[model samples]
Target: MSKRYGGKFSPEEGRPPQTPSERGSFRGARRTRAGGRVNLLFFAPLPLAARAFGSGPTELALNLTALGALLLAAWLTREGILAQEAYEARKIARRPAIPRKMFASLLTGLGLGVAGLATSGVSAAPLIYAVLGTALHGFAFGLDPLKDKGMEGVDSFQSDRVARVVDQAEGYLKAMTDAIKRAGDRQAEARLERLQSTVRDMLRTVEDDPRDLTAARKYLGVYLMGARDATIKFADLHARAPNPQARDKYLALLADLEQNFTAKTRALMADSTTDLDIEIEVLRDRLEREGVHLETRDLA
Candidate 1:
């Protein structure tokens, strides 16, 4: 019998293990707010499926149409919640490209109205139900953020560049995430998520100061692409033959990449602080020249 290598590493060989607190810090830290009601929406329309199999063709048609519309509304609502969460997470973000939640509300009302019309036949109940359904859906999900945020005084051209680069980097991260899932190792998935978090820190830094995008371009583009490719290869190899050596190498690579990304983010922050200090000093000098004796007591 051949021995199959598992991806687990011995504590003596690998990097020092993370403390329980450190590991648990992120366990419940990140979750979307679109779960409970959104999931319920999926089941709520199941009864329509059975109704679609009615004896009358008109009844079947109406039920099938309502079912499709309701499912679409559920999908739109879930996507809108996710988009809103992403928007909120960023210090600077454009409004969502589509107002999915609002559209979902409209779709919900349309679905309900159609169902009511089919059952009640030209009654005021259908109109009342439509209005109530739209209102309730909107109330539950809320409206999409309608305006760009934290974009004042920032060059639109520079911001656009940063957005484009960040979007590309996100695609790379998504690929890595999808590929790693194929490996079926929970630890590896967790490790990849940690590395992704580090990368996102750098992304957020760049987004806050578009000027940093030029300096950090290589890290965001070339380095991240390489990491993504390596992840893809590792996932494939690990799935076929789970080699401990390969797993260790991959883990080490992730550690190095995380460290580099973290260091770069710190450097960018330091640069911003330096710029602020320079502006303050220039302002102080100008004030002194103008005979405005600003108190320096707080300089202690």
Candidate 2:
């Protein structure tokens, strides 16, 4: 018999089978309460286009400017909402340097005022519309985070370093994700995601204690960069030839990496716990030296 090289047809050929957990995981991934308001703001200015066309050249220019300002305000509002969410997600996060949402509200008022002026030149109507627009915009999208979070006693310099390193590590994760997609293997992508999740756990641990940034610098910087390069090479090779053995090896590497990251995070947490215990013990000893009596319940 002549040698033949062929495999059975698969409906899911070149695609990984979806797992139960993967279903609905992405349904609300990008959906946010603020997102709806952002959408509404974007659409609210659409009427200005028609109004601009019907008006005189001066009025048309004013309406168009108002439309442009409103669109910019909408963009800024969306960005501010996203920034606030990111800030809330982190255990230690700095407030946004610029208050984008507050500025957005101001821009909204300016836009409304300009539009009103275009419709009725220099009248009380413009002032009322401006005030109402500003108030409504402020209500719909809250102000940006105004204060630094979890940085009360922490060194600003060390926190900045942690932020920089974490940002770079995230870039590595993003690069890995992008590279793996070229391989056209959803299984590989899923594996990468699992590994990335473990990596993020370590990142959160480091962020919680800026001191850990020094210890984890090698893992976050050097090791992650190496992993990213390896992933790019593996993705290229896998795209050319889908080798099961190579896939298995890559997954094994991911398993090893995840194990190390989890261990490191646990170690950092342990160190923090130890420090806290020592501080508590020292405080108790100081109280005892001061001749303070403590009941067993109070000590406990």
- The numbered model that scores best in TM-score is 1
Q: Give TM-scores for every candidate, taking all chains together and pairing residue i with residue i.
A: 0.87, 0.76
Off by over 4 Å in 2: 1-31, 174-184, 230-250, 280-300
- Highest lDDT: give the candidate number: 1
lDDT of each: 0.85, 0.84
lDDT of 2 by residue, 1-300 (tens): 896554557555567776433342242245565666578989999899999999799999999999999999999998898788877767676789889999999999999999999989998999999999999989977888998666667877777777778768888998999999999988778877877877777888888778888888899998899889989988999999988998889878877887787788889999999987888778788899999867646755
Number of clashing residue pairs, candidate 1: 0
Worst 10 residues of 2 by lDDT: 19-28
Task: Give the poorly placed runs of model 1, Cα more than 4 Å off.
Answer: 1-30, 297-300
Which residue pairs in model 1 clash with each other?
A: none
